[model samples]
Target chain A: MEANSSPLHRGPLIAAGILLGAGLGGFVDGIVLHQILQWHNMLSGKLPPNNLIDAKVNMYWDGVFHAAVWVMTALGLRLLWAVGHRRDVPWSGRTFFGSLLIGWGLFNVIEGIIDHEILGLHHVYEYTIRHLPADLAFLGFGLLLLLAGWALVRAGRTDTTPAAASH
Target chain B: MLKLLATLALLLAATTAQACAVCRPRVEAAIHAPDYTDTLLLLLLPVALLVGGVLLLFFSPTLFSWKPTPPRSTVAP
Candidate 1:
């Protein structure tokens, strides 16, 4: 293909989408699970946070996790800005949105496996004695997200307009 | 090399150095615990996943060999 007519690079956009999605997904997990539901804190598994001091420690770790995700989100935004200016990146809503879903799904899968299963860090709903059910459900949700994201990305394959031209 | 060694020595001394009664146990546990590596890994898991996922997505074109299709006209014929 001619240089001008060459296909846009989807890497940056995909990177942006995944990072933003993971960051936002992490926020949801932190807010909903840690704060609202009180299902688990960052160090709940190790320290249990039954008392004020332990809870404070867990809260500190939670803040750290949130800070890390915030950095990830900011980096994603930076990548999005860079990709938007590039003539080789396609300005497809489908691609961007699809990648976002993929990123979120990837987050759930990776986090769920590492923290929930491998590390025994915490569960989605920790009230019950049998935490496996809740963990399985969380993984199931992740699988659904992955399927939906994959479908959207496949659909986005048809979109070919350069981002610069779209604007 | 001397600076690096000095820094390492300082770090080692800091961990063993006296602290308040309240903080001493926690600090000692963190340093001397048999499972310190496990604790560190657990702490790093989420950050690793976030970074790794982003990198994977960034290089997805090469991994998946994505090809650009021709743009479709929006206007109806």
Candidate 2:
């Protein structure tokens, strides 16, 4: 691929993919837990209840918070794919991996800050001793995504350069 | 094959194990009586967006990159 192939084509496609994937993936939380499993609300068992009216409002905002999570998952997948696809392009592995890690961190941090903290939608630890396994499973999934994304970006960097790469 | 086998084993183990009282009831309820109205709509919203995103990512072609499919004649030959 020529330098003229400039990685410019990546922007909107990647952005759109990330936003969509994150949104959809985040929706899985609400669907599987709240609606399906009926285990509890995503933010439930964590926050103290105010009143019946406030509880309903909290649930409503909880849905919105989950929507934001879905959006972030979209961004994660987009970064992974966009960076992985640029192996043949002139992009460096450092750039790709760095971008992906930063992107994932930013997603978590921003969601944590705005949606969870500021909005008072939920907390980081929303589980009892019995539900520890479930909480850990979700956390593990997140870590795996970040790791896999980083690996792809790192692999792309190495393969793109003739000096570091044999093939 | 190994991954599938491992997954199957895990599934088997999970099934055989005594269920957590609270967890079991919830899971069973979800399977037997899914409230589709409010939940289904919310679930589909994200899924629809994802499908659209994937299509744009892999299939959409630009002016230079576009591969035109053969146009069919209105009348059959």
Candidate 3:
């Protein structure tokens, strides 16, 4: 087959999109769940923030968590800049956005399982005694995003448009 | 001129940035905990897993393609 007929390489683009999505997902959890709602903290499961000192301690740890996610976001942007320079990767918005969704879903699923279920580090809603429902809901939402993203990405495979660098 | 002076003053006051006098004791005590390492690792686990998987994905996309619906132009010129 001719080079023109070969499949377009999309790994770099997909990877960049996923990294960005996961980083954004982390921010959402940190901001909405941890700060705005006052639901839980990084070590709330292990050390409940019941008092002023303990709450301040948890806040400090939360800052650490935020710093890590910021790094992830920065890395994703750098990768995207590199991917734009390549000629092989197709420029499909569907593929990129789908990848973002997949990344977010993966973050939610992995974090929910490890942090909320196995390790008991924290819960989705720690204010209540029953945390199972909230945890399951989080996982379920992740699964839904994963499936939807997979479908979009699969559809994007048929697009023949090349990236700007190739043009 | 005022902003510059204020910034310099703030930099000089870095030593007192830990916490207010009231919470200084608690903050100082918490800062020296041995369990911080454990907590740090536990917290970073998920991010590590995701980052590793994404890096791998960058190299693996060339291995396969959807044969049923190939791209219209396939290779970019």
DockQ values, each candidate: 0.21, 0.03, 0.35
In order of DockQ, best first, we have 3, 1, 2
Per-prediction TM-score, chain A only? 0.93, 0.47, 0.93
Fill in the DockQ of model 1.
Answer: 0.21
Q: lDDT tens string, model 1, B1-77? A: 99999999999878453444566566455444686567657766777867876777566666433455433552336
Complex DockQ, candidate 3: 0.35
Reference contacts preserved by each model: 0.37, 0.00, 0.54
- Residue-level lDDT of model 1, residues A1-167, one tens digit each, is 24245645777777788888878888888888889977767667676766655666667667777888888888888889887887777677877888788777887888788888888876666656788888888788888887887788778766666676778
The best candidate by DockQ is 3
| lDDT, each prediction | 0.73, 0.45, 0.82
Candidate 1 is scored at a TM of 0.76
What level of docking quality does candidate 2 show? incorrect
Is candidate 1 or 2 superior in TM-score?
1
State the interface C-alpha RMSD of candidate 1.
3.5
Candidate 3 chain A: 10-residue stretch with minimal lDDT: A1-10
After superposition, which runs of candidate 3 have C-alpha atoms over 4 Å from their true positions?
Answer: A1-3, A165-167, B1-20, B61-77
lDDT tens per residue, model 2, A1-167: 23323322333333333454355545655677556764445345433334443344336545655765655565556555554544333334443444445344334444444434454334444444454455445555656656666565445433333111222
Chain B TM-scores of the candidates: 0.44, 0.33, 0.50
B1-77: candidate 3 lDDT, tens digit per residue: 99999999988977864556678688658845898888899889999998998888887855434323443564456
